[model samples]
Target: MSNDVKRPSGRHHGDLRRVLEEAALELVAEGGPKACTLAEVSRRAGVSVAAPYKHFADRDSLLAALVQKGYAEQRDRYVAAMKRKVEPAEQLAAFARAYVEFAAEQRPMFELTFAAGLDKTKYPELLNAGAELFEVLREPARNLRNTEAGSRDLVLAVAAAAHGLAVFVLEGVLLNVSQAKDLAASSARAIV
Candidate 1:
């Protein structure tokens, strides 16, 4: 044997976990959560069968990571959308639009995040993600509370309506993103 040792061929420094995450997401998008097996993800990512275990313990953990990413993306979208509007009502409407847009853009991952079988209690990271997402709306909600007209429960009602409308849009009942965004925004404005 030569004195020099050969490094692992395909094991790059920091991208394996990301590659696995992307593979799992693609699998989920293609066939839902059941299709996102560690084995399949590793195979798709061109890594060994044991690769995903190094990043995530099992399928649920991997799925939870995806959910966390989804929430983070949602928060970012809401922040950006709301930042462009000056009035409190416009900000609320923008938040509603971003929520619907996130669902429209990442329908599969969004659905997976809200999947009933995913027992969110097992993942504290998901709780933090949810908190961060909601925190993005806090200032806007509070501002709206002091503005023209809104009930104490108006924020809660608007969130519920947005979620319901997003679900309807994903299920094809809402037909188009334009209509869904309009419905969500109008429902939120009407609530507040």
Candidate 2:
């Protein structure tokens, strides 16, 4: 069976780029960047194989755009998860849980965004998106720690612990559900 989902097929000429981007995202979500080809993305998007080149310079550029887009979605998820809690400490736990959930649910994107070894400096938009994503976590940490350095350290520690649990879940050493969530939350507590 094809991993390609049925995307909206009626993109106008001006929005063909969006169609291609959506198709590429589905391809990456299914099987990481290597598995996604411009030809395949065009096919899924109801465009010609040459269509992707019109929007993206090359595959790496498309992957970079995907990374940038993924960070935007990740930041939104973090904010929504953190909003449920009133306390800064609880917000930190929520961040960890949401991080783990994102990893488990979107493992391909998680790896692409973090471990793909892509040179983010070449992609300015991706770097900005990453900075914004980290700021989401740092927002809650700022309330808990007095100094800037301390807040940065606390956020890094929590994120590191959360990332470790997410890797465990992805590797199947831990379940991707509540157990992973509990571990992520508890690890954040321990870090702080």
Candidate 3:
């Protein structure tokens, strides 16, 4: 109802659900998950406040959808990054760098993706989407080690390292680094 609130740009007709999702993401991107409200999302999407109810039950449901979409996009980025390299080690490094860089670039969405109190049972799509990203990492990891147990362990280790780097960078613990990608590559190489 606030005329001053800006509507999200570049929306087109058809798929009102997608429009609402995009509007919600824009709100979250600008000011974290708490800033996203159904009213605000509907307003920004240029729909009546009641309209969002048709697509989502409430703000939490919308946030869950956003989390699901975020995981899918993040997985796509890792997959694309891996495709750019042919060697197994290079592909693993690419996945690490991509994971860290995505966290850096999409801070708000990144934070929301890992937000507390996320009930996966209520949102199985969120759970499944998140699991897919980890599955992508296992491919290169299997190449790094022969046995299934060894590859799974190596994948966990590599993923933990990359996630740690991302958290450190986002928290400003690694501000002096000249290039995050270089450090990520070096760290990944040490492991492989």
- Judged by whole-model lDDT over C-alpha atoms, candidate 3 comes out at 0.80
Whole-model Cα lDDT of every candidate shown, in order: 0.80, 0.83, 0.80
lDDT of 3 at 158: 71
Q: Per-residue CA lDDT of candidate 3, range 93-164, in tens? A: 888898788888887678788863578888888888877887898888888889889888877777777888
Error of 2 at 113 (Å): 1.2
Best by lDDT: 2
Global CA lDDT computed for model 2:
0.83
The deviation in Å at residue 86 for candidate 1 is: 1.9
**How well is each residue in 1-192 modelled by candidate 2, as lDDT tens digits?**
576765454754788988877787788777766777888888888887887888799877878877777798889999999999998888889999999999988777787788556787788888889778888888878998988899999999999999988988888899647889888888887777
Over the full model, what C-alpha lDDT does candidate 1 score relative to the true structure?
0.80
Q: How would you encode candidate 1's per-residue C-alpha lDDT over 96-141 as one tens digit per residue?
A: 8888888889977787778725777798888888877766676777
TM-score per candidate: 0.84, 0.84, 0.81
Locate the minimum summed-lDDT window of 10 residues in model 1: 146-155
